[model samples]
Target chain A: QQPVQSPQAVILREGEDAVINCSSSKALYSVHWYRQKHGEAPVFLMILLKGGEQKGHDKISASFNEKKQQSSLYLTASQLSYSGTYFCGTEPGDYKLSFGAGTTVTVRA
Target chain B: NAGVTQTPKFRILKIGQSMTLQCAQDMNHNYMYWYRQDPGMGLKLIYYSVGAGITDKGEVPNGYNVSRSTTEDFPLRLELAAPSQTSVYFCASRGTGGSGEYYEQYFGPGTRLTVT
Candidate 1:
């Protein structure tokens, strides 16, 4: 099933913080986060497999909750280069990943 | 090494025309997938293969067909193009699945298909 993401779009200023959440009705084994700029392929940011493991990159991080079947992406001190559409893809079944509708994040100066 | 590659970066097709979107990976991955993304929307799976000669339908498989003739290649075929088939198509590949670990998927730049 497709995961649900909150706040279809978000606007942030430089150095601001924002959070995007994705929830799935079914249990998930892993949650993958990807970002896609205009006219480009989605690039993998990070993957959360084990429950309660938080992965961080630069000013971005993500947390996965196996019990809740949800995941959250945290962006700290957002930069203009961070502007893009973020998608949370969940692996509910074996060998397949389904993505959420996506949340658009626009970081401005 | 090229992870995953897709052909025909852009193509314009007439209604009822047929074409194939080719994909190949040099990572020697056992799993390959085909997905389509509409304007401002998330990607929807079209088809996937776990190994050579093993293919399965995905969420939005209608109007599309796929073949996995080799471990390094998986191609998506549109027998008869339609306006609804117009979208950006992406090809991805990953290693085998079994352990409870998350395998990263490498995606191609994608093919932009337009049906008139």
Candidate 2:
């Protein structure tokens, strides 16, 4: 099933923090995070496995809660380059994934 | 290396027409997928392949067919196109290892298709 994302849109000033949440009704095997700029393909950010591991790169990070079948993407000290739509794709036991409707994040300087 | 490439960046089709969207990866990834995204919406998986000669349907596979004769190429075919098929289609692939949980995908630029 497709996961559900909260706070469909986020607006933040530079150096501010924002959180986007994704939750699924069914158990998730893995959660993949991506960022897409206008008129461009989505770029992979990170993948959180079923172990509830929290992974980070630069100022961005994500956490997956296996028990809750949910994942959260954290934008720390947001920057202008972070302006884009954030998507969370959830995969069940199967390898195929179902993506949640994206959360549009606009970081202004 | 071109991580992933798609052909005919954009196209328009008439009702009942047919065409194929080509996808290729030079990374030698073993998994490929096709997804369609409507404006202001998330992508929906249409089809996927684990390897050559192994194809499977995803959540939104209707009105679409796919083939994977080689690991580097995966093509999606649309027959008898309809208006509802108009959307941006993306082709992605990832190299998986270990427990098969690290599937960070590489996506192509995408092809925008419109059916009238």
Candidate 3:
């Protein structure tokens, strides 16, 4: 099943912060976050495996809540380059990864 | 590294026509996947391969076929194109065996197909 993303779209200014949430109806083995700029392929951001783990990149961090079957991505002090569509892919089993509807984010100067 | 590469970035097809979307990866990953994205919808898996000559059906496998002849290639075949099949297709690959950890997947630019 496809996961659901909250805040379908959001606009933020530089130095501001935002969060994107993903929820799945089924239990997830892992959650992967990716960002895709207009007319470009999706780029990997971070992944949170089961066991309630958290991972972070420079200013981006993600946490997976196994019990809730959900994950949240945090962007601190957003930059213009952060503008893109963010997708959270969920893995229910061992082999397949299914993506969410996606959240569109626009960071302005 | 080229990561993953897909051919024919864009194509327009007439009804009843057939075509194949080619996906290749240089990372030598053991797992490969094919997905289709429709407007306002999340990507749906079409097919996947765990290794050479090992293929399996995914969520949305009907109207599509796939083959894994080698570790580097997994191709998706559309036997008879239909308007419903118009969407962007992406190919991805990931490494295997990380203690149930999620390995980052490398995705291709994607192929945009429009069936008229």
Better of 1 and 3 by TM-score: 1
Cand. 1 TM to true fold = 0.97
lDDT of 1 at B97: 55
What is the DockQ score, from 0 to 1, of model 1?
0.88
Ignoring the other chain, what TM-score does chain B have in each prediction? 0.96, 0.97, 0.96
Docking class of 1: high
Q: What local lDDT score does residue B1 receive in model 1, on the 0 to 100 scale?
A: 92
Maximum-TM-score candidate: 1
lDDT tens digits, residues B1-116, model 2? 99999988999999999999999999999999999999999999999999999999988899999999999999999999999999999999978887754768899999999999
What lDDT score belongs to each candidate, Candidate 1 first?
0.93, 0.93, 0.91
Q: What DockQ does model 3 achieve?
A: 0.82
Candidate 1 segments exceeding 4 Å error: none
lDDT of 3 by residue, B5-79 (tens): 999899999999999999999998999999898876677889999999999999999999999999999999998
Which 10-residue span in candidate 3 chain B carries the lowest summed lDDT? B95-104
RMSD, every candidate, angstroms: 1.1, 1.1, 1.3
Model 1 chain A: ten consecutive residues of lowest lDDT: A44-53
**lDDT by residue (tens digit), candidate 1, B1-116:** 98899999999999999999999999999989999999999999999999999999999999999999899999999988999999999999998656665588999999999999
Q: Rank the candidates by DockQ, best first.
A: 2, 1, 3
True contacts kept of each: 0.75, 0.91, 0.88
Candidate 2 matches the true fold with a TM-score of 0.96
